[model samples]
Target: MDETIAEALRIAEESFIASSGPGGQNVNKVATAVQLRLNVFALRLSPPVFGRLKTLAGTRMTSKGEIVLTARNYRTQEANRDDARGRMIQLLEAAHKEPKLRKKSRVNRIGKEKRIKAKKNRGTIKAGRGKVDW
Candidate 1:
């Protein structure tokens, strides 16, 4: 576990609920679904990282700036809990990375000429397919 993510997890809140799916009587008896909520604004992330995190969270983020994640794929509560925590860690790690800056690329003269020539050839072919003016 990363220190940053671990620190975030320290403040995270978790709850368990009954999962809806096939699991015989055990599903009704056991609360396997884990819901993890983290307050993004509470974390000590920079503004850029926080902005990116909010974007990446999409609908998972609440108006209060909390990110909620649910995991119910497993039959056991521990597994589901681990799954949810793993997902949060992954999200945090992605948000931690700085996005690559895009460089402006210029088309060379030969490339420009080739593109123009291709466009002209395509136009000529299309023109030849039309009804003859004669």
Candidate 2:
């Protein structure tokens, strides 16, 4: 993960933009929000890892296979930059892990019987709500 992050950082492009939200006059004057863009193709991830990363990135992943992350939670540019880089690292790490295969579960015979019994009871109750004869 550390090596992946180092490679990512080496190819990442960072830009600073003015942040929006509570920060008094500083928000208007200073550009603290950091936008980090990294080309996922350059990472040379496997097809499976790339698929996972694609799903994880959602709209953040561009058609060009670049992942863009924005961090403005902090007031300082350096802090925001670190936050963006950290998020990117987290994404890469998560992609590296393989998802566990799900085991199919079946309802026990007793549980199925109970469910069918309750369904029959519900049907009976509904059948009782008939219109009255004149």
Candidate 3:
């Protein structure tokens, strides 16, 4: 893992709660769901990365700038904890990538000609649909 991501994880807060889904009696008794909260602002990421992280987080990010992730797929608290950490790492890695700059591309002459030809053909078909004046 990257140092920054490691550092971010170091400061992240984690808690466990009872999962609502399967696992029979164990699910009813034990807290297997993990909730991980990370303060985005505290990560001190650059503006672009932070903006991307916020967008990627969507509703998971609270107004207070803390991202909350829950993992309940497993029946064990440790499994869920690992799952939550994995998800956080995935999110951070995604946000860490710099977006590719889109290059302005002009339509090639052949493509433009093909488009015009198609338009003319469609226009001819439409014109032929009119009632014959004969």
Structural similarity to truth (TM-score) of each candidate: 0.88, 0.78, 0.86
TM-score, candidate number 2: 0.78
Best by lDDT: 2
Candidate 1 lDDT by residue in tens digits, 21-102: 7677899999889999999877878888898899899999999999999999988989899999999999999998899999
The prediction achieving the highest TM-score against the true structure is 1
Location of the lowest summed lDDT over 10 successive residues in candidate 2: 1-10
Candidate 3 lDDT over residue span 4-123, tens digit each = 799879999998887988799998889889999999888889988899999999999999999999999988898889999999999999999989999999999999999999999999
Lowest summed-lDDT stretch of 10 residues in model 1? 1-10
Query: In model 1, which runs have C-alpha deviations exceeding 4 angstroms?
Result: 131-134
Whole-model lDDT per candidate: 0.91, 0.93, 0.92
Clashing pairs in 2: none
lDDT of 1: 0.91
Supply every candidate's count of residue pairs whose N, Cα or C atoms clash at under 3 angstroms.
0, 0, 0
lDDT of 2 at 10: 91
